[model samples]
Target: MAGEVPAAAAAASATLLALELAWSPSTLTDADIEVLVVQGLLLEKAISGWRSYFGEASPSEDWTATVVFRSFYEKGFGLPSGAFFWGLLHYYGLEATHLKPNSITQIATFIHLCKGFLGIAPHFNLWRALYHLRAYPSKGTPDVVGGAAFSLHRGGKYPEAIFKDSNKRWAEEWFVVANPTPGLLPRTGLPPVVNARWEEKPTEEEMVEVQVLLAELQKHKAEKLTGATVALSFAKWLTQPI
Candidate 1:
């Protein structure tokens, strides 16, 4: 590994997991399946933490890591990646990772977090906060909390509207033009992907509160999701919804 992760960090992570595993940590929940599920989530986090601590090897390291994490959280431990996407969703909402809503799992998550948070409405003024946050803002965050980097588009000035979710593309064609209120916009035109394979198209009510937040990127005009900064943008997007 070029970056060379220190042995100390690895050892510490291993010990933490070992301690949790040894004590039958699942005792709080009597159900074996529940215990197993939580244990699996913890294990997934430990492994990812270890991998991140190491060097950047995979060209698409972050993308691959995303798949690994999602698989463990969504499939393995039965968790979804966005219990709380970005800054909009509340921390308490993380507990409801199990509540899988209709099709837009991430969107439902955003709504839940917004409603649950119940205060500290960030003044919705990200620009000012960034200025005060420090003498300078990070590259992605820039001078605003909900800037382009936090956008799903990740990069690009005019918003290519391609690199985002296909279904979202259909949503966006209409979304950008309409007035949104942290909720889903009604459907128009054909849905992105539907048929026997997808089973059905997501209904308007089904995705009513699912918000669509896309912004322009700083560095590149045409959005691209194949780089480190893109992944960092995604992290920023996930941690703090715009």
Candidate 2:
């Protein structure tokens, strides 16, 4: 029975790793899997804490150990190892040693984590924020803010008509563009010079304003669920009336 358990876990773990690799090239890393293994061993210690209270046998009614075990199992599965050893122990209702770390799982997990961290994997929130800002600059924003809020309802047409010259235009020869605000055009005239501040870093007031804006944005996003499909949500947002 013991031998069969490990074999089953190994098979399941391989299957999970294959599916993950097929769906997305990046998901887990070697270092992450090592952490999960250590976490699994630590999870086993919780059982001993309960055992000491109720003698050699842990009481069947104690649920704390079960929850901790599940957390460890989930962490293993999340790393693409299928949490095989965790599953085997859970099935037998016993605490057993963690499976030795496999290089394949570690390598695959590392690749996955790298891709996600580098933004290669589809990052919906980033895209959504960009879309929202471009689509509606004036809505739900501070009164002092000013920029192009051109309507994009027309299909395959520029937001500003090609011949419209009402807005002042600036020649690239006059000034060089630095790190300006994204999605906004440069001013038509020379930049204004301001007196230097007492401190080199941003003032506490500036930090407070940034925090206020972040809090507002968080509140706006609270209505939406992060688990929703990004592609589908984006398609819907693109087609919906602005």
Candidate 3:
């Protein structure tokens, strides 16, 4: 009977932890939100252009572009830095995969961040931190969520289980999107687009819409993005070098 009681206690503890992850509000700061919005906008532009240029061809054929885009997504959002979402997860001592409902919601949050800028649907800021942690390359660090494993180490969302089992080669779809171009010019002057965006400021009616969205996101649970769109945006963002 005593053993049974201990087992029950352990089960209860596990359940409680799960509940905490599910119910906890992300500890995001104003700065973090600003960065996410900026990163999302940039990615939207990059990915859109990549898709348009590449057409139906696979992105694996253009590796330099892929790495550059990943760098923009990870580094641009301060994913590897101490002040971003990873810091929040560090505060809680949880890994990206261990997030509330798992990694899907985290992935959804990245998508939403971009869409949110447009004031579109599913603007929930769910998994704001976890998404960054999962997407950023860990550089073989054991303390960080990703280590030496290719699936976990590379920038961008960790490979989905379906991706692994589909026999379509997730690695090719993800890591080796295309051949690397040594002569390609790096995209550094991106219009300071995010700063210019903030300068516009929100309207009074827009503020009310934002408030309503926030209220909904507070209670919302977590929530792909197509390859054509991603490739087009990325290609255009890099090739034009503007």
Strongest candidate by lDDT: 3
Residue lDDT tens for model 1, 62-171: 22222122222321122223222322223211111111121122333223323333222222222111111111133332221111122232232222322233231111
For model 3, residues 18-50, the per-residue Cα lDDT tens digits are 533322222323343345336553333333233
Query: Candidate 1 clashing pairs?
Result: 73-79, 86-238, 86-239, 86-240, 87-239, 87-240, 87-241, 156-217, 156-221, 184-208
Candidate 3 C-alpha RMSD relative to the actual structure: 19.2
The CA lDDT at 159 in model 1 is 20
TM-scores, all candidates, are 0.18, 0.15, 0.22
lDDT of 2 by residue, 79-183 (tens): 112233233223322221111112112222222322333324322222212111121122232111112111212231111212122222111001111111121
Candidate ranking under lDDT, highest first, comes to 3, 2, 1
Error of 2 at 52 (Å): 71
Q: Candidate 2: where are CA atoms >4 Å away? A: 1-203, 227-232, 239-242
C-alpha lDDT of all candidate models, in order: 0.25, 0.26, 0.31
Candidate 3 clash figure, as a count:
26
Off by over 4 Å in 3: 1-64, 67-109, 113-169, 172-214, 219-242
Model 2: pairs clashing at backbone N, Cα or C within 3 Å: 26-112, 27-112, 28-109, 28-110, 29-109, 29-110
Error of 3 at 98 (Å): 18
Candidate number that wins on TM-score, 1 or 3? 3
